[model samples]
Target: MIVLALCLVDEARCWAAGESVRSVVDENALEGTPAALWDVDGAGDPTIQGFATDISINRGETVRFKVTTDASAFRVEIYRVGYYRGAGARKVADIGEAETFAVRQPECLKQAETGLVDCGNWQVSASWDVPARSRSGVYVARIIRSDTSGASHIMFVVRDDDGGSGILLQTSDTTWQAYNDYGGNSLYEGEPAGRAYKVSYNRPLIVRGSEYRRTSFWANEYPMIRWLEANGYDVSYLSGVDTARRGHLIRRHKLFVSSGHDEYWSGDQRDNVEAARDAGVNLAFFSGNSVFWKTRWEPSIDASGREYRTLVCYKETHAGEKIDPSPLATGTWRDPRFSPPNDSARPENALKGTIYVANCCRFDAVTVSADQAKARFWRNTGLDTLSRSQSVLVGLRTVGFEWDSDLDNGSRPAGLVRLSSTRLDVEAALRDFGSNYGSDTVTHNVTLFRHKSGSLVFAAGTTLWGWALDATHDDPDKQSAPTDLRLQQATVNLLADMSLFPASPNGALVVTQAPPDTVPPVASIRSPRTLEDHMFHLPVSVSGSATDQGGVPAGIEVSVDGGANWHPANGVSDWSYTFTPDRRSFVSILARAVDDSGNLQPVPTSVTIKVSGFARLIYAGLVGLVLGCGALLLAFVARRRRLLAKRRMMGL
Candidate 1:
């Protein structure tokens, strides 16, 4: 005979065991439901051991079963198919009696309602009361009846109370799974490999997996999570979240974290995340490659009658048909649909010092020693150079990612940490300290710019994070050991300054004065007329260039009388304006610049078009007869003069 006992556990890990079995009905499982029969006799004969079929139960209730076999010494068991691979089954109960045996239910099956039914030989029931703290999704229960002879497995699923609270993590379908393993394809473990080239370049990574299964666990250790938690942030660890519900989920969190090599995303996911950002929900791209690919999800059921999820992308595959002209590429896939002509425009680098660095670049943390501050400016000639040697890489070299060439250069006051390069013993000192990768032989200078946003964005740069490690040391020599501390400190200062802005209750705007050389000088009309009527038609033509140090000439004002009044010019170009001069009066034209700061530079000196009555009559008369005759005579005379000059000069 087979004897079985059951144990139960509460949400707090407390446990209890039971002896007797009770029959519980599942409301979802009514009469006429298919049931399986088990043979308890060891004589190899198949006997239809009858058990209760199709029972119903309400939510938050448990059902147990007591099975009595007709055979005196036969062992009977129950088994349920699985919903998906890796999902185990639950053992409802086991029985052992004179000609019949009794089995009891386990406690783990009591808290939630699972939709399993009893097939007489064994009993099946559901657990409906899930704890409030549990994240939402489909939970599963497995019942196994085991003895010395063999074991049978049964499966059931429970729907959670709040089913869509988790974040969906995804990866590029084109990316090779081989790279999914750390130390594979030059990627560390837990880091999803991203497409090597930009989207415009057309080498997007493909997807390989269930559409509904958007998340992948690449790198186990997500540093951003630790950082957020350390700073008292609330976070939930979840797998795939429903695409439709993502927008709502994002609203609940102040910050959304894409941790550990998140390289791919569906159109809906990207749009939802971007919308959240636009709504003021901050995003921390803790991973390297993010939102690089597009994918689609398809729903199906697994062997265990639970929902099966599959995702599709545009890569050549043997089993499934390829998504032609991939929805990601063609912009037609639904749900996470992204507009076609996939926007290759990168996010604005407006966050101040945040910058994207190329791979394989060596970064050192050098401190600004007291002695090094005497220099007016510094340029890294070599310490770290870009691996690709691409001109675009120049923009990535900075103390923090936030530096802008046009805005930050020479904008900060002196004593603000500056970067400099020297062919001195810095590398040798580092070598002595056991650093091997970089050495004195390194030829190129490392170009570093001070971050202007202060430190908030600077701290976002991963290099500064490493530098911060060295800054915390107590000993002066050890503190200054990295030699990049000055650059790092300058970065920290930038972040600190930015923190003040966000933390302040009053939303005060910050402004800095323009450099002296950047200021525009004032000018006015000194020539042919006043400031009025210079109108013309669409094809009208005029010519003149404005001059300004910082501002660009946006428009020109024309006046017929000196300074009495003025009218705006027709068309404006870089420092130049073109329009027809006033026909009724002598016209004077003035041009000025409009800076980005909305400040207008002084108008340039005006050009005067002097019109006289007699002159106008003379001009009209000369237009055809005198002008044609004068042009022909001038050409003849010029040709003759050129012939004579050539003969004389060349002795021809």
Candidate 2:
């Protein structure tokens, strides 16, 4: 019986220990070796997986990526993320089968069914067809296990180190067709009228079907990417940033860019991006109506067994809809009801400029103030429109509007601009004006909702892509001509002066030490001053009624007791230190002055005072007065008694 029990116990322990299993396949092992690579261990049977990794190349440059999987039926899918002013994510082109000549066998192919399998490596090579006007930024590529259930992703960002030029792009995971349209598969009640008819609605319209399907694409025609590559820029492509990773992603880039109508943002994503900007990160809004609606993502499987990552905008249905009401209407999430409200006055719309209007051919240019010295003209781009209108105006200026003196009355310029004019000289004028008004132009409008750290933010107002448009200056397919050369120069000049892009000084430490007696010095007493009775005020003042060489009052500092201690006399405007002594035996006062450069005065001014006890003297005086009064009373009584005795003796 004991022997039988020992055998059973040994068997149970073996079962409990479990087996060491390897699931992931290795690609390097197949190099230069002849082995059948197959089978990835998992819950059930082994399946093959395929993936596409995106890479950016110059017009003639070539790039490659590697993929290895064990399952069968492996294939890759490649597409592009299209661009439009108000359009959401739209798909274009299927590049999976397009690069037939670019594919090469893995270094080695092997098949194994045992412990671990080494799948042969695969490579993809391709060159970019540089468009004349691509903006430099991130591009994406995704690799998936065709027969399995896993994916790998890659990215590229275009850079121009020579000129210190680069573009930043912010991409979100999900795009919603309409507010609360969670499924995204269904069309809104009145929408789906086609592109041409949709444009007639004067707002963002919804679209449906696979043609409008919103998904990840890395190998499509990205105008900005093409434009950058064609112009010889090095680009880097990053994956879309969701709320969970936005903060980390934004810090890695100098500029934060958003394009193709980024209307929805999760609260955290919005806060992170805003925080990044506050920390001196530049922002370029290449898309329209951004951050107008807050959205939430719902990750779940749909009826088709495919994973659906849906974004929903329910601002109107939110609990504090009235208190924290959204700018958009209740049912329609299309309208951008940006906070602080955008003025609808003519010639001033925050999102103003000629790009949208001219492309759509809806608005006309209007004349604004003309100043020859300031380079004024009526035919300039949206930027020109902003300058001309604000120059003659006496009040607040409205962005993206035709300057109308009658409408604005005399107010500050709005945050966004939609200039009706487009003249080279006018553009120059706006650039010149922008130098002085850059911070005021963008921040003043949204001051209440600023990030804690000081972030450099600029609203392009126009979607010309600024420097990116310069690459396509000579291209026939260019939409708007490169911003006028002179105007571009003016922009450079303004950027150099603006706080966002301050010019570096020649020397590191121009003013190492404070100048002599340049400003009044401030002082205070650090040690406690004692008084006979606690009846003294502390002494604090500016040292020396000192005057700056420029005739300005030199600031000063004061301390009690001949410079024994010091404190800052921040509030006192005069040059004197006075304090009531505390109820202690001894005390001292001192004062000194420090200039802006932190240079202390050669000598400190101080005063000391000795207090004697006066309370005992007051008590002695009271006693003396009482004794004199008593003596006087006794003398009067004695005189009266003598008179009475004398009168009685005389009468007898």
RMSD of 1: 20.5
Best by lDDT: 2
Taking the tens digit of each residue's C-alpha lDDT, what string does model 2 give over 15-84? 2354221011110111111111211111112122222222233322233444334533333332222221
Clashes of each: 91, 104
- Kindly report which residue stretches of model 2 are placed more than 4 angstroms away from their true locations once superposed: 1-167, 172-221, 226-240, 302-308, 315-454, 462-652
- TM-score of every model versus the real structure: 0.32, 0.34
Kindly provide the TM-score of model 2 when superposed on the true structure, using C-alpha atoms: 0.34
